[model samples]
Target chain A: MTNEMMMLTNLNCPTCAAKLEKATQALPGMKSARVIFGAGSMNVEYDPNVLSQEKIRTLCKQMGIGVATVVPGPSSDI
Target chain B: MSRYNDWLIRNREKLVIATSGSLIVAAWLLRPLGNTFHFWAMTLAAIIAGYTVAKEAIGRLSTRQFSISLLVTIAAIGAIVIGEAWEAAAVTWLYIFGGFLEGLTLARTRSALRGLVDLMPRTAKIKRGEELVTVSAYEVKAGHVVVVLPGESIPVDGKVVAGRASVDTSSLTGEPLPAEVAVDDTVLSGTICQGGYLEVVAERVGTDTTFSQLVYLVAEAQEQKPKVQRTLDAFAQWYTPAVIMAAALVYLGSRNMHLALTFLVIGCPGALVVAAPVAVVAGLGNSAKHGILIKGGERLERIAKADVVAFDKTGTLTLGQPQVASVTGFELEEERVLSLAAAAELRSEHHLATAILSAAEKRQIEPAPADDWTIEAGLGVVAHGPDGEILVGNRRLLLSRGTDLTPEQAALMVEHEEAGETVAIIALNGQAIGLIGITDPIKPDAFGLVKALKRTGIKTTVMLTGDNPRAAQLVADQLGIDEVRAGLLPEQKVEVIRELQKTGHVVAMVGDGINDAPALAIADVSIAMGSSGTRVAMEASDIALIGDRIGQVPGAIGISRRILGVVRQNVVFAVATVLLLLAGVVLQVIHLGSGMAIHEASVLLVTLNGMRLMK
Candidate 1:
């Protein structure tokens, strides 16, 4: 499992962040997902074996949310 | 070609808008030919535009929520049901176009912080066993010496161990000027190195860096809504459903399908929903760009309306560290007097003791061997020596032992006291010798900041200090402060702030947030100075100025007022536009197309107004 931060785009309301958070959490192999609406970013902890970062971007795009520039987190201890 | 294909797929909504919008224009142009040609063109336009609207509406309905897109979709379909194809086409087209433009602008505002995250360096060069190796910035261990070259960002928070360089700390301080750095100086992550080489030992990496904390703080600030914004948001929640129910009522009563649909189109409250947050986002961004972080929209509101401003004198006004400025001895040398005071204060922990000890050491005065050092509460300490018993204290301490200050000595003590120095009188064997003058000079920014605060309409400026009256008065006089509260403990500062607040004044206090925690917490708006180094400073205060300059206090207040003003204007404008659009529908003067245009225009206008604060 690894955790990463991704900058989200076009989030006009805080509720959009909530909706996206719920969607990401429901995905398989995801330990947790949180979207900070004000910061336009999301933090996710997931098993890379079941779900890849590339798939997360595609899923968000389908939901009308754009995810850009995946920032690597210190995933060792996390 | 692949990028072009990606763009086309991503912007399919725009394609729908373009195709439908052109169909409407085609229908208008072909009107001269016949009603049949115009009817078909308009019908096709309605179908094309309404498809995207319906997709979005269905997507939202699956979530079991009422959204603006749902209202727009229903309105467009209702127009088509009434055989008003032109109205149906115009309604959907206007909604999509307005939404497109709104998305573009709001996206820009949201990127203000995303831009900061992008600047974080992803890689670092760490020295391995024999050679330097490139590693991910977060993977680098603490104490590893990392090399930063010209034009690259420093990847970790650490002190420079080698090399001379000019570093741009603008990312951290919002200052564009390159700060000069050499060995032993501290450098932070996310700041670019400009034409200089430096080796830094990694201390805090990744999210633990000060720059990352700033980003997180700003994000947290942006999420917190002000009191007025909370009220407006609650109103918007009810207003949208009310508009839907009102439209249902209007349709039942008048059976005017067009009028009811028009009401639905204009009643989304889109502008009002976005008004306050957009302004707040812009305001926070503007302040962040200046290295000043306001806690939240609520804090911004309080700062904007602050009436009385209070300050902590030591670290907030003067440089907190006192220094020995002058030493005067009537019958002995100046260095001898300093050595005598230093010996008496050798085991003392008073702030002024450090000044005396440093002064003696700088002059290479070997401290006279002394024993039995005892400190009196208000007076200085007494230490016994070989030749005669040495006494270093105030005139009262000397008077108690029957050694009063001579007239000339009294004049000298008064001069040093008036000059804002804490003087310690040194006496040997019950006779006065000389005094060491220790002064904590006022910061250069304090005087200018006071005048600026006055110009910004801060009616009363107060100075609260734990120092003596003479020292406190000296600062008050130099800064032209209106009120001086001297010899105040931390709790007394809180009382002073509360007293001002009782008289119906909004108070703002600026302090170091350590000893001044009580006053800072009690004040309406607490501003912490030089918060770049400590998390406690940011957490304890309502606002944090990362730089040491207190002059930004007035600037922060002024900018907050302007932001608050813009927020009010946006809110009022949003409500007025909605009300006006509804009135047009009631008077039979507005249709779905014109109503959607006006609503979108108002929303865009409000967003643009908020963006003005970004500059």
Candidate 2:
């Protein structure tokens, strides 16, 4: 499993953030997903063989969240 | 096509606002021509604005989630189904506009941390063989020589190997004064050099620097939810589903789907869900910018309710450095007695030895070499010198050596001890010679801090120390402390804290030593002072004051209290708005557009209230 963090540009509502986290976590081979509403970022841990970073970004975009930047590894700021 | 799709994705909100707004304007302009043109224009407005809301609602529904977007989508579709296209268009447009305003206001609250991140210099000047080269700050490796000119930010944590400068450290320590840095002095990243050029050997780069650690700690602190936030989240979990069920029952009972749809619109608890986290983020971020690091939301709550505060003495209340206060010689000059004591302590590694050596240095007395040095634990040191046998220790050491102390000398020793000075007896040739008084002076802000804590509603301020009772009492009296616990071992300090907790007092322990760790862990809130150099103390503390200023204690507590007040106010405001909107919907006084307008206004108000802590 690999952990990654991405800047979420339009994550405005807490309810939407919670849903985004749940949807990401429910993905196959995913460990956890945490969306920090205040910081406007999402952290996810998932198996690379099951789902790629591009697939994760696409999923978030389909849910109306804009992923501005994707960086390998969890956010050190957290 | 992909480029256009990307543009549409980036500007989705703005597109919704513009399309709906222009269609509504066209509907009004075409009203006089015919009802057909006006009706179709209003329908187009509703569909364009409702498209995204419906998409989000359906997406969440597929995942078995209920959200505010779901409520807004239901309301807009219901309005359109009832032939109220204008109401549907207005509701969705207003919701999107409110979200845009909220995003702007939320960004303002996060500006504190953003300012800190911006302070880091982007590029650094480093020496590469003969020529100087510029590189990204994060790319500067350890052991590289970085050059910092005046008015430029230091790019990495390093030691100065050449030149001198005074640097502004306000970003790190919250101290307004600029610190003068000479050769071999360590300089921190993110601080600006105010004068002179410096060549610093990088020791810590990237995230290892103090500035990065502070930013990381603050961000992590903001993410930790408080008990209040957790409770609210749990309440929201049931609230959303319950509201939808209630709306279904209302429609069945009253046979009025319009009122039921309005119920759903008002039921979205957007304001309540955001109240505490927004306040916690802004409060923690503002405090971190000022060099006070409250670990998390739980610690902030503890600091708010703290009634009694306990302070450790040595490095906390007083300057930890002890200095020789006075000297008295029985049958010789004061200078000779100090010289003998310094000579005997030249090879000793005791704390008192440093005091005596510093005192001798102040008097321009160079300590002579001594031989046959012997140490008696808990007593003093004895040595054979060129002049005679030198003895420097406590009264017990001198007495055990068969040295007789006159009544006058004993009285003077008692007097010095009562005045909060540690008395050390000096003897020569196995006879009582003189005595030296060493004292750790109280910090200049000690008294003021006590008064400030009292003003912040602290019921009692107690001083805890391992010093003699008389000395502890003397310092306590000067600081106006309510109680003094003296002669306590390290474990005894923890016992004191537990006793306070047993008595039902919310206690906060402030200390700056390894001995204070246990007590700090047991207290309701533990604060560590001078955390800039002490990683252990920072780890042990609930709150770490990077600066050694005693005044920040009250400042931190006061900030916590204000944050708590704001959080409570937001919760109350959000609940009241929900109740009022529910009542308005049942009475059929509020339509879809008006209900959404009020709902969005309430959320924005709560956000604005939380942002007040930024100051």
Candidate 3:
């Protein structure tokens, strides 16, 4: 519900069974993240100048969460 | 060898072979022991079965390492170690047999969906030069022309390139009647060639076939869990850890190995874990039986939580056809006006024009002869008739000819248009004399469905449509829709749904097909008018009404809410029984027999309760 990045990631958990909680610390360039817990998928919105997807996934893994995938929203589509 | 890998391969094969051979051997071996000993064997079978069942279930569950099978296996071993041979064997057999029966029931649930694969044709008849080759559907190529005989299912998605036929697409689309397809009309794989033979050009093959997609949708639906299940999983996330801790405490405090094993076996959470899924599968089965195809548990879950319902206008609410309703003229007979209009509309492809021509044919009004006929795009058709220049279309079309209608006739046309009635104006000798009114009738159950949705406390009911605002509003007004968003493009429909969902209400959008896909996807719950919808629409929707009536929309929502309620009850009942029995074990009042009996009973109880969702 928050204005976060929409994450399209495959869930290591049950499809549609994950409780998606937005990470508290924003990535340097990211505005928000939309994580679908069951699908193990996440969509993150970022300011290209600030943070990278690789950085976000590394941080999330350290936090004990797996980022199965990360894709930008349609607005980012060319 | 590591015990884990050694056990994985060896134990899996052992369990499979043992269960199969034991079933046959037990029937003959247990006869000498009489009914009491047979009961013991059955009990022992239950335990062994429980372990095997738990392993398989855990594989699917993928939630944690703790398994009921391990618990039962350990308990049986402890009983034997304690020298309670008869009791241990009885417990193991009963647990195994119980699990076998449960597995049988769950397997049957899958069979209902699997039966869909039978809908595809086994072979396809492909044309190559002069020879007709009969080959498997998998061998069929895109763009290859395939001949479908009467009563055969089309093996691939293709366009009708050579013939015309009334294909039975109901199996694919849920529409009861056959759809008439002519040259250039695209036919999907899995639709039966009902009344005629036709040559179709295949466009997509194999896995990309419509049948495969339908099967996938059904599977996906079955696997989709409601948000409630997620919450349940979150609970399990902590629950599993807590149970492990509790089991450890009981073992350490009692210093009784048998009691510790009993605790583990009894605390398996088998009934609790299986309860929601079983109910969901059953609910899906019930939906499929009635032509409603729900794609996932999440949709059912969201439908249960929906507080707002948005409807796509073209097909969901009104009969998609805009028909000729009435004809009003002071100077000309209605039939005469209709005949003139029909003659001019005969070559028109416009939906309203087709309606007029069909109406004229139905009324047995022979179209007047015309010459030099020309249809002006977005306006009326002008033709040279025996009565001079005859024009038929809208007021704009008639006015463009410098033809003026009588004040009364003009007023009538204005009134019809204001009321959202599509009227075809007829002009004889460049003078407008009459108006033929057309209206898309509100679906018979539209109002009732809307009212039922209201009773469920869904506050918003918006109708998104490509129709003129007036026409859309008329239907919306009748249906008691909370909002009317008219004249919207397909993308705009999605935008409206997104905007509405932005308000935090769990929104449900009900529509027919491609026009409704984006909107349906954006909404929390997407319902397709399955019975009369396109394959693309059904795929995009999370839920589909097998029947065309809007009434099923509410029925589906009701089913979802009830299923959720039943799931809640099952969880409560299963948990309560476990806690009660464990209390008895702690008090030392219950033995292995009573614990196993209670466990099976609770499982049956929860399973029976879960089946209520099927109703």
* Highest-scoring model, lDDT: 2
Q: By descending DockQ, how would the candidates be arranged? A: 1, 2, 3
Candidate 3 lDDT over B91-124, as tens digits, reads 5665555655554455456555445655756689
What tens digits encode model 1's per-residue C-alpha lDDT throughout A1-78? 877878886564445677789999999999888787777888788999999998899888766777777775424232
Summarize candidate 2's per-residue lDDT along B1-615 as a digit string, tens digits: 877887787677788889888999989887998877887788888888878677767776676766677777877788778777777787777777767777676666556655666676778999988789998887889999999999999988899999999999998898899999999898898899999999999998865676766655554565677888888877776787888899999899999988888888788888897788778877877887788888888777888999999999988988889999999998999999999999999999866998999999999999898977988899999899898898888989977887767899899889887777898999888888899999998888776888899888899998888988888899888988999999999899999989989999999999995778888888899898854466567756778897777779998898888888898999999999999999989988977778878888898888888888888
lDDT of 2 at B180: 97
C-alpha positional error of residue B369 in candidate 3 after TM-score superposition, expressed in Å:
5.7
Q: Write the per-residue lDDT of candidate 1 for residues B211-316, one digit (tens) a residue.
A: 6666666656766888778878677556667888999998898898878988888887778877887788788778877888888888777898898999999988
Q: Higher-TM-score candidate among 1 and 3? A: 1
* Each prediction's DockQ against the real complex: 0.41, 0.26, 0.03
The Cα local distance difference test for each model comes to 0.82, 0.83, 0.70
Q: Candidate 3's interface RMSD, please?
A: 11.8
Please give me the total number of clashing residue pairs in predicted model 2: 0
Interface RMSD of each: 3.5, 3.7, 11.8
Docking class of 3: incorrect
Worst 10 residues of 1 chain B by lDDT: B530-539
